[model samples]
Target chain A: MLNPVIEMVDLTKKYRSFTAVDCLNLTVGKGEIFGLLGPNGAGKSTAILMMLGLTEPTSGMVSVCGINSTRNPIEVKRKVGYLPEEVGFYDNPTGMENLLYTARLNSIPESEAKKRAEELIERVGMAEAKHKKTGKYSRGMRQRLGLADVLIKKPEVIILDEPTSGIDPQGVRDFLQLIVSLKQEQGLTILFSSHNLHQVQQVCDRVGIFVKGKLQSVGDIESLSKQLFTESLCLIEAGIHEFPAENTDTKPVRKLLEPINGIAKIEHKKGVFEIECTSDLSATIAQTIVNAGYGLNFLNKKEYGLDEIYNRYFEGGIQHG
Target chain B: MKEGYNMVKKKVSEDTTGNQKKVKRPAKEKPKHPFWVIVNKEVSDHVRSWRFIILVALIALTCLGSMYTALNNMGDALKSSKTGELFFFLKLFTVSDNTLPPFFVFISFLGPLLGISLGFDTINSEQNRGTLSRVMAQPIYRDYILNAKFTASMIVISVLFFALGFLVMGLGLIAVGIPPTAEEFLRVIFFIVLSIFYVALWLNLSILFSVRIRQAATSALAGISVWLFFSIFFNMIVDLIAKGLAPSSFAPEYVIVKFQKMILNLMRISPAQLYSEATTTLLMPSVRSTGPLTMEQVAGAIPSPLPLGQSLLVVWPQVTGLIAVTILLFALAYVAFMRKEIRSS
Candidate 1:
């Protein structure tokens, strides 16, 4: 059992009367990519700030690599690499110079720092433009340089806040691929926050959904859907040529399905009927439909994706709040 | 199953301990202090900036102009044997003709500009450029950045002043054909140090404004406004207030003296006033005291120039007052900066 590399115990932050992050408890295991999914103003950035010890928490504790963040921020900072949302660099310095400054701040030896800076520049694919001042770089290039900047220190746990916020689809894909490759090559634990559901679903091993400063749920898509729905859904698309148009003609099918235990909802759309029931009731519903002489042309179970799960939890959170 | 679980647990514990050891291995080579890193960066940045160049050029040109005029006047005074020849080297800095004020007086008036120009945008520009939080995120304490900025700027200011002082001394030596005596050299050094301290007060004040105000232009305006109020209008305002309180003309002799003291005390609040008074006392040893002396107090005193030690004694309170205000302003700026949120806009 690997211990979690990052842990937050009942962390909370309040600005006057309004709470930014409510008593949140989170633990991220070693070498795992955890996604913090939320809409804008969902306390993800605030939580990241507290974890980095850049902002003081109103209450509770944060620890990185078993060291208390507030008690010894410099030690934790040494092990954590943060690529902030919309990252910026000194405009007057070249990309190489910027990285060298960061390297010097981390106290790497001058020769070693220069070597690593050159390697990182090439690795991040900015070698051709390494000598150009950063003010002239495009957004995509800047973000890539930002990644190189963070990697210069070789931190164990990397935290990126909205690393793909303003990039095009192709840029985002390339950037995320680089991130994943870094994780694989260095065995680094990554925690990235983004509101893009597709991106989160594509990269994260597990995810935590937050709404209104509250954690709605946390799990992989399958587990989250299982926990939320607590039942199975089977859609039977039948092309019945002799389908009855009157409501009275479907009474027998409705009666048969209503009598069965675990069957919750049955709705007819077009020539298909959707049956919501417990996991084991799908077979029974299919058998009864075919035995009733209805043309059961196609039947399939609908898999819930993260979008549906996120919407369900998001709406649930709003009502509960 | 139970045996397997125990074996896995033991392996995991060993792995974690091994990783911890690997992390600690680099601790043998200690890193440079973050303070010096920031200082080096800041000093280099300042030296390369156009603002420093322009200000240095401005000071140099004005000082040379004043030196030329003073040199001509000193030649005439030497030939006529009218002005006393003691501390003639020091006269290059303080002597004036019909055309220009002395070099020391020019510095007293323009020194605040150097301090303000360097510091007005120090913190605010970093914040605006979105570099403050990134720099703060490094493995260093929060106050290191602020301390480094102050220290680096002070060092630059000291270097600039000392260089200019030496230049003036060399020019004076070539023209006057006389080396400064030991007393004169020490007095000039003291005067230079005092000038640095005075400018530092303004530097700290502008830094305070920079930390509080987010816009670089606004902070610069605020710093200059305060300077103008002190340099241009503050004395007039103090005189008006003193007259309203004591009405020096209608009051008795002691009342008039009291009003005069009140005015002097009020003017001392300005760093510029304190600087000028202290420098005047240090460079012109003929000056005895800051306050006006009564007839009985001056009755038994000789009019001869005081020595270096007594001149320092005469200006010691003003010097301390300047230092106290500088520290106070710096403390305010430090507290404001440390408490400020390091969020990028």
Candidate 2:
């Protein structure tokens, strides 16, 4: 197995009594897309910053590609690409100029840096806007340019905070696709935090959920879904309310059935009863209802996407171990 | 399940052991970037700024306007005598070489403006834009950042001072039909050095202020406030103090001499005052009466204006003091900046 490319071992950061990042132990394998999900003040940013060695950890350690980050930050930086949320540019410079300067900072050779910059700008869909002065660029365009600048280095680890924030839906999709492609094509390890839960869900292989400066849970999407949220739901509509138990051995004739398993609860309102059950029971339960009832008007299993999963942690007040 | 757990433990150990044999990657081979890359960046950023260009142009116009007026009036005096015209233009153009001691008036008027313009936003803007953190994140030494800023400001101040020197010299040449003597050149150089120090004092103040105040606007305002107090209100306080402490003799000559001495001593407390005095002494060779004093009262009160070297020696303590103060301020800025927490946005 490949060694983890990024590691934070019991990393803690404290500012006075406020613990920004509390004993975070995280690892990113050589080619994993790891999402750090949290709301505001969850210390997602603080964790990434400590990992970058931009902020010193009060105690513990961070390493990038096996190099101790704190003791050798510049060396670690060489292998990392960072895109800060709300990125600021030398406003007077053009987009190309900003990219070139960042390339220089990363110690990329001038000729190679220029070529790489062009390629990144093209890849990030900023090729047409590259010549415009940064001050004149809109926020979305500036973000694209920022991403392009980070990609100019082709770093082994890419750490981005809210890479999709403030962007239109189309732009978000495009940016996520670009990140996915980078990971797939280059074997880049990504450690990105975003408020966009759906985007994280679609791309990330594993996620670390944070709340109130602590990691609430860390696992693959399926496990987190099963462990944290197992309430399967179904929407069913019936022509008659009579069933075998209610109608004295007279079952309402029905057809057009789908399968379900275990039904946990049923709520009837406006002639439609919503069924909630454990995982793998929705299809079996739905089929049972439709075959027994007179007319199955609607029978569909409900899939709670990332928005619900995100709220389960944020609103449920889960604590970190 | 037990076997899987054991396998996981073995993998963890293998990883930890692999970490133990950590091999240091060879430092990437990078060519030496010439010092000029940084210098060019600094110079281009500053010189291209609208603030710098507007400031230089406005100052030049103001100084030249006043000096032209002064010379025109002096030209009237020249109509009566050849000696008067020559003396008039010399006093007007060569501020540091005037017999009548006009250097104080010129420098006191110009020094603060030059100083504030050179340093008002040097550190604050970088901090606000978050570039300071990015620049420091590189492998370069900490001192390089501070020294580079100081050097860039110094270069700019040097360029402005010497450029003014050339402008005045050219005008003098056209008016007098003779270029400056070598001694005159030496005097100008001394004056320029004092001017640089004067600017450095402001830069130092601004840098310190920038660190203390998070906002660039606040730093600039604070710098201007310091300049205003020193240049405008300092002398008024000196006069009030002198009036309150007058001796019983009440002789105007003796009183004036005593007053002049008190004024000089009070001005010594302010760097701007020390700089203006230095410029005056460098320019004037016969400022025997520093105040409205009779010859008898000032019998030994005033010394003959010393040569350029002695004038420098005279002000060397003040210059050294200001430089020390500047370094101290810069050190404080460095410490403050280094300790600041740079959070990702």
| lDDT score, candidate 1 | 0.85
Report fnat in order of the candidates: 0.49, 0.15
Model 1: runs farther than 4 Å from truth?
A231-302, A315-321, B1-31, B76-83, B246-250
Instruction: Give me the candidate number with maximum DockQ.
Output: 1
Rate residue A127 of model 2 by lDDT: 84
Candidate 2, A31-62: lDDT as tens digits: 99999999988888888877777778999998
Q: Candidate 1 versus the native: TM-score?
A: 0.87
Lowest summed lDDT window (length 10), candidate 1 chain B: B75-84
Cα misplacement distance, residue B165 of candidate 2 (Å): 1.1
lDDT of each: 0.85, 0.70
lDDT of 1 by residue, A232-305 (tens): 53333433334444433655667878888877777766645667776646677778778878766666776667
